[model samples]
Target: MHVVIVGAGEVGRAIAANLESSHDVVVIDQDGDIVDELTYSLDVLAIEGDGTEIATLQEAGVEEAGLVIACTDDDETNVVVCGAAKTKSDVFTIARVRRRTLLETWEGSQGAFGVDFMVCTDLLTAQTIFRISGLPSAQDVDMFAGGLVRMAEFEITSESPVAGLSVQEADRYDSLTFAGIFRDDEMVVAKGDSVMQAGDRVVVIGSPDSVSGFGDDIVTRTSNGLEEVVIVGASEIGFQAAREFEEHGYRPRLIEQDHDRAREVAEALPNTIVMESDATDTEFLAREHVDEADIVIAALDGDEKNLLVSLLAKRLGVDRTVAIIENLEYAELFETVGIDVAVNPREETAEEIVRFTRADYTEKVAMLEHDRAEVIEIEIGEDSALQGGTIAEATADLPEGVVIGAISRGGDLVTPRGTTVIEPGDHVVVFVDANVLDEVIEAI
Candidate 1:
């Protein structure tokens, strides 16, 4: 398959890198320097031209392309690029936009902008924040199999009860599976004897109840639980996040420095408390009792300000801190400095787009630890290697990095075991090392 991507920014570059291994990828950008860098950095063809132009689309072989993605910074540009690609060919088009209004417009009338799929960056980030906040100590969370199966990644702190326990010993949840463990720079496929050490990020997949139970056990929860929420900033992402929390039955507090923006959000969000004050003001925070909040989210306009807000919240005795980071390179730095979780909008958008490029059998994909590993839900076909055989028998022919996390059959959750038989039409959620993802997809 040939994939054509526009705007060689973080989102485009990420999608290119993920697909270049299996498909013929071509990236087009207006910036000569970024195009030149991508040409050498990734194993994909790079072109320097305006992706919204007809001549540029022809130059990138849009007619023969199976997928075309537009991910420029401007929403209008991305929509125009997709519309232009549709004029040239019947290729599947995806547009990455930051505005929820555009996504809603597209959703109301599918294929309105000639885009077969649209990814809203701000809305996706807000949804991600809401999902992470719902869990006790999760670093990342994703739902698969139509919300019947959930995959979550959690950090094992030294004080965690399951920090030093083996995988078998820590496997207490009824329908949970310890999929993989990510130690510093190393991806360890979970096994019965695999020991989960402190500082390791463990990925689990199971029913929603079981995953929630596992999370509660991993971290000692406060008596009040995660109730009080404070969001700093009136940026689109922050405003959307506050709205998400409100819709989910929590009256969150939103702090905006600008008076006009604060008044606007206050009127728009009936359940959220909008405050017009600088989030950096320590005295204001003290007066408002921000120190008693369960979680503080920094979604300011700039990365530096978000970092500062997250650090201040931590110093103010917040239980958890989540910050929205624009620069991908600063994700690790923010987490290391003190932020509990750093959400990158571009990364999230890339993951959402890349899932559409997977095989027809793959229903969903969740990238973990910045693509170190992946949890994918695939439906079993009659000719699949997994069908008509026990998991132990089927896995013997597979690589060591694959772990069958859960099985969904006829809308029922099925816990995977060695002797479990995988029938046709069963949706199996599997955790696989990124290195072996292609092989596993091909085999299953």
Candidate 2:
């Protein structure tokens, strides 16, 4: 597949990095320095020119490309790029728009602009924060197919009522899949007979309604209950994080270096406590009760600041610490530094844009940290090896490290047990780590 990406900023770079492996990608940006930098790092064609210009699009082979993505920071530019690309050819086009009105009006149908997909990063990011915060006890919310499926991460604290029960016994309320469990530094693909233990980080996937039921029960009985969260930084990402945490029943404390900017954030978040303090200041963090906070979110624009704040929070005994890293170059350092999760906002935005531009047959493609691997959902063909075989037998030929979470058939979702058989036309959701995606695809 040939893809032409307009805008070579963080979002554009991310898209190129993800698609360069499987598709021929051309990136156009106005900055020559950025173009040269991207060309060296990513194996994609980089053109230094205005993406909205027809000449630039033509030079990038937009007419012959499989898709054209206009991901410039400006919404109008993105819309114009999409409109221009569609005017030239019948290629798939996706535009990144930040205006809420465009999305709200688009609820009825795709407008005459012929944009196949539109991504409102702020809106989606806001939605992510909102959904995560809604379930106060949920550590994270992973949505699939525009909220059709939801996966949540929750910690089983020492005081949890579900501490001693096996996964099969704990799932008495509804059908569930214990996708993975994180303990110490290891992540284990869970089995039905696996017993739940204290301090285990569990990833559960199921219908939205059932997932919420489990989260409520865990929140009510767990001592690791989150009451306060601290956000370090005053970027838009930080504001979104604070808003989401606040919605989840947590009182988030904001630490911003600038006093006036802190006041602005405080105005937007009436319930949150905003303070003017340097995030790198260890003394200030201690004085602000950062140690007692349930979670610490480092959204500082600078990578060094994010790293410092995360380390400080971790040292202060903040149980879970997440940092928003704009640069993919530093992703590897997070694991060694003990950060729980690093939120790649621009990368996420790029993934969403790519999904929007791709053909309808492509279900999902998720990129893991740095350049390690991708997790994708591929529909089962009529004659695929996955059909008409039990989970164990079906996966026997599949490569190792490919974990099948569930199979969606007709309208019913099944957590694949050893005896569970996958028939023709089933939509199997598999998690493939970075090393084995190709082998897993071959097996399927």
Candidate 3:
């Protein structure tokens, strides 16, 4: 299938990088330098033109594209591009937007922009921050099989009891499985004999309770008395994070640099306390007693401000810090520099939008380990080839790297074993590694 992508920004480049391996990808950008860079780096066609122009779409062969994704930095340009593409082709269209209002408008009005789907980076970023905040120990958290199952990554602290233990010894928690370990910038498969070293980032999959329990054991922190949550920005991402934490019953004190914006956020988020102050001011943060915060979120528009505020929050004795960073390069640096979790809106949205490009169109697909792996959720069909077979028989011919994380049938969740039978309508959640995703789906 041919895929045409507009805007050769970070998100567009990421999508092309992932899709160009299996599908023909054509990226459009006005900047000749970006186009030339993508052309030399990725195996995809790069065109220099305005994506919203009909001539540009034609030049990119939009009519022959199976999917057209408009992911420019400007939301209006993206919508217009997708809408214009509809005039030339019947291709499935997706538009990436930073504003949540556009998402609500198009969703409520039944696709007013001729967009088949809309991906909101702010909303995705907010959700990512909230997910990580709840599981303070995990560097990243993603859910599957409704809310029953979860996959989380955590850094093993030197004080962790299981830091030096083998995989078999660390597998003491029920319903939880250690998936992989990242040490010294390389990924190691988590076999029985694999020894978990300190500073290693470990991936775990299981029920939410089990994953949370395991997280608590690895990273030491007390969430009991630290009821205050300090938010270092009043940006859309920060506002959304405040609202989400409020829903989960957390007291969020939102600090905004703009006075009017603070008032607006305060009115909208009645459950939160909005204060006007400079997030980068250590004196101001000290006045707010940021040291008592259970979690501090750095969500300012500038990456430098977010990084500075997060470091200040930690210096003030905050238990955990989550930073919303736009630059993918800075994301890894944040974690390495002691930020609890780093959320990248562009990367999160890219991971989300990449799922729709898959051939099978599973119920959900999550990008893991910088798109090196995927956790896919697919519903079993009544006439499917896997319906009547046992788990062992069905997966016997499949590769060893794919692991069935969980199964859902009749609204009930099951941690499957070899004896477990595959039934029609069962939702199977599998963690796939490397390039075996296509083969795994084929076998199923």
- Model 1 C-alpha lDDT per residue in residues 253-352, reported as the tens digit of each score: 9999998999999999999999999999999999999999999999999999999999999998888999999999999899889799999999999999
Error of 3 at 16 (Å): 1.1
Query: Model 2: per-residue lDDT, tens digit, 1-444?
Result: 899999988888878876787789999999999999988999999999988888889999988998888888888888788888877889888887766567666555765466777777756665554455445446466655445456777778667778878887887755566676666656566777878888676777666777777877765532345577788887877887787777666677889998889989899998789998888788988887788876787888778889988998989887667777767668658845777666665666876776554435447755433324344566788778877878789888886666676667776777667788888777776666556665576667
Extract clashing residue pairs from model 2. 133-248, 373-434
Highest lDDT against the true fold, candidate: 1
Model 1 TM-score on a 0 to 1 scale: 0.98
- The reply for model 1, stretches above 4 Å from the true place, is none
TM-score of each: 0.98, 0.72, 0.94
**Compared with the true structure, what per-residue lDDT tens digits does model 3 show for residues 1-444?**
989999988999999998887888999999999988998999999999999999999999999999999999999999999899999989999999999999999989976898999999898888888888777577778888788778888888889988899988888877877777778657676778999988888888888889988888887777753477888888999998898889889878999989899989999998999999887778887777888788899989889989998888888888999888888899878988899788889989898888777636588888876777777888988765567888778777777677677888877777777788989889888777757776777666
Q: TM-score for candidate 3, please give it.
A: 0.94
The model with the greater TM-score, 2 or 3, is: 3
How badly does each model clash, as a count of residue pairs?
0, 2, 0
Ranked candidates, highest lDDT first: 1, 3, 2
